[model samples]
Target: MPEPIADFYAVIPAGGIGSRLWPLSRADAPKFLHDLTGSGQTLLRDTWDRLEPLSGPDRIAVVTGRAHRAAVERELPGIPDKNVFLESEPRDSTAAIGLAAAILVRREPDVIIGSFAADHVIRPAHLFDWGVRQAIAVAREGYICTLGIQPTEPSIGFGYIKKSSELIVEGAPEAALVERFVEKPDLDTAREYFADRSYLWNAGMFISRADVLLAAIEENRPELHAGLIELAEAWDDRERRGPVVDRVWPTLEKIAIDYSVAEPAAAAGRLAVIPGHFDWDDVGDFASLTKLNSHGRGNDLAILGENARILADTSSGIVVSQTQRVISVIGVKDIVIVDTDDALLVTTSENAQRVKGVVDALKLTGRGDVL
Candidate 1:
């Protein structure tokens, strides 16, 4: 193992609109900006709460769109205003993460950086920290390491990582080489992966040195790498950055980090996977939210906000009424009712994933206010 780096930096890609949890999660206030759970804090704030301990208060940075920069800052205090990288437009995950990697290299060439999505959910802070520490350990050994959560069930929503063989690294005994990354499989394939215990749900959390990631991006997507370098050079200069960014941002390739770096790096024998032994959930849609909010009252009824305003009579489902309006359901089962001030979403839990389709329809109808 190589020498361990003491200074660690955490980057959060917080640009998603979370269309699956629409109405409550709008363009102005995305899902990460609001507390979908009863956690008393927003998801972005919760992400900071957990990562701030592993990486110090000043070492964390968030890469978001220009519209949400101020909201991200308001949620996270003590973060230097310069640490936040505001992208001019929406590129995919690759640009959001690559920007942070390029900036960290400019600051410190050897700094270890880990990226965690702002919309996921993890529990028991100590356990989450342990997984991150192990990932950093493997990452120090010149491998792009990702935390792989053991699957609790056969979930088709998440992509999977196939664990090939174990690796010996100091401070991390449970790390293994990632054989391959599998896309969301069918029901039969998902069940086989779970039963055989050869797959772990990719948490989309990755750790590596700043230089390592930059080199990979340069090797895979040279065009994006060139643009990112130009932006990073002007990152400190207020006068030149805006002009350079406006010119280069939209022209960069639109690709995910998994396609641009991780899958290719795994082919080249430069990727590793650390088993995350803690509880994790992606909170992808209303169904996941319902599962996370279940407090042993059974899954019959899961109400997120203001239970006093909900009336369930011979009904079993999930209801989220943000305005605290009286929501009455009669003789309904497995139905999902989300009532906002101006929009209402009514669907079944089984069709929760289709909620994104509703968002698409709203866009076609030019209902930007509710979207």
Candidate 2:
């Protein structure tokens, strides 16, 4: 077992609604609160399990929606009430992570903060530990370090990080200066990037000193930096915190950290990439969710829920049930059936990415009750 890194703090941003994985994932109850992997642990809990060993319980914080405050608290009992940063409204990653950084920096100026997403899946815990150690080493050297995953295929689903010359940081020998961050590309471009050893999948796992990150954000996004700093100043005041957050948070810019910090940092040669050698997945859609389930992969099908049985002949797909009903499929290849008490999602693995469209339609039709 690896010991906790000294002066290390972890911030988990768990705010997204995950519309793509709907029926199973809802607005009030996001995918992170459920065990999509059938691992008997919710994604949020699994994240805590992996990170608690590195930062220790007291050094970890979670930034989530106000509506999810209770659920997040219930899921992560080890975290103190103050460590749970609840947003008045979703202001995207920049604000979520920025506020966390600002508060932690105020608490401890020299603290190294690592921002990890609440719903990602990383395996072989030991590899994750080593990668984090490398990132921390690079971060301590005043570089904003990101753990870039080794791309296994030409995946157009994720952003890519272009790595430049190797960074000779003492403790992190394999660290590389990041060239730039590329958005999701065309399939042809993805194939080109995949063949190149210089590219890695951008998992958005950033490790840096809290002050360093806040400084980068301040340089790149002054307005957001000011608002966050203002909020952080009042964070510890019981009476003033609520009023300040309500007044300033919504007015803040709604931009991702990539736009507000990482891109600018990369251009200025302040960003470093530590190649991560762990199995990881964001579990963005049902198709990827299918791959995570042991029984759902390969020969036949994947099924979620303990008593949920399925009757199928010559079919290959996944079935997730919230109720104790037997789902049957016939001659349907690559099918996906998600049955809940209120809603049922029936589609193919090919159409997995389009699931978000359904949620949008629901909102348009004023059917948010089902959402």
Give lDDT per model, in order: 0.88, 0.92
The segments of candidate 2 whose C-alpha lies over 4 angstroms from its true place after superposition are 294-297
TM-score of each: 0.96, 0.98
**lDDT tens digits, residue span 119-143, model 1:** 8889987888888998898888899
> Candidate 2: worst 10 consecutive residues by lDDT?
291-300
lDDT of 2 by residue, 161-238 (tens): 999999998889789999999999999999999999899999989999999999998988899999999999999999
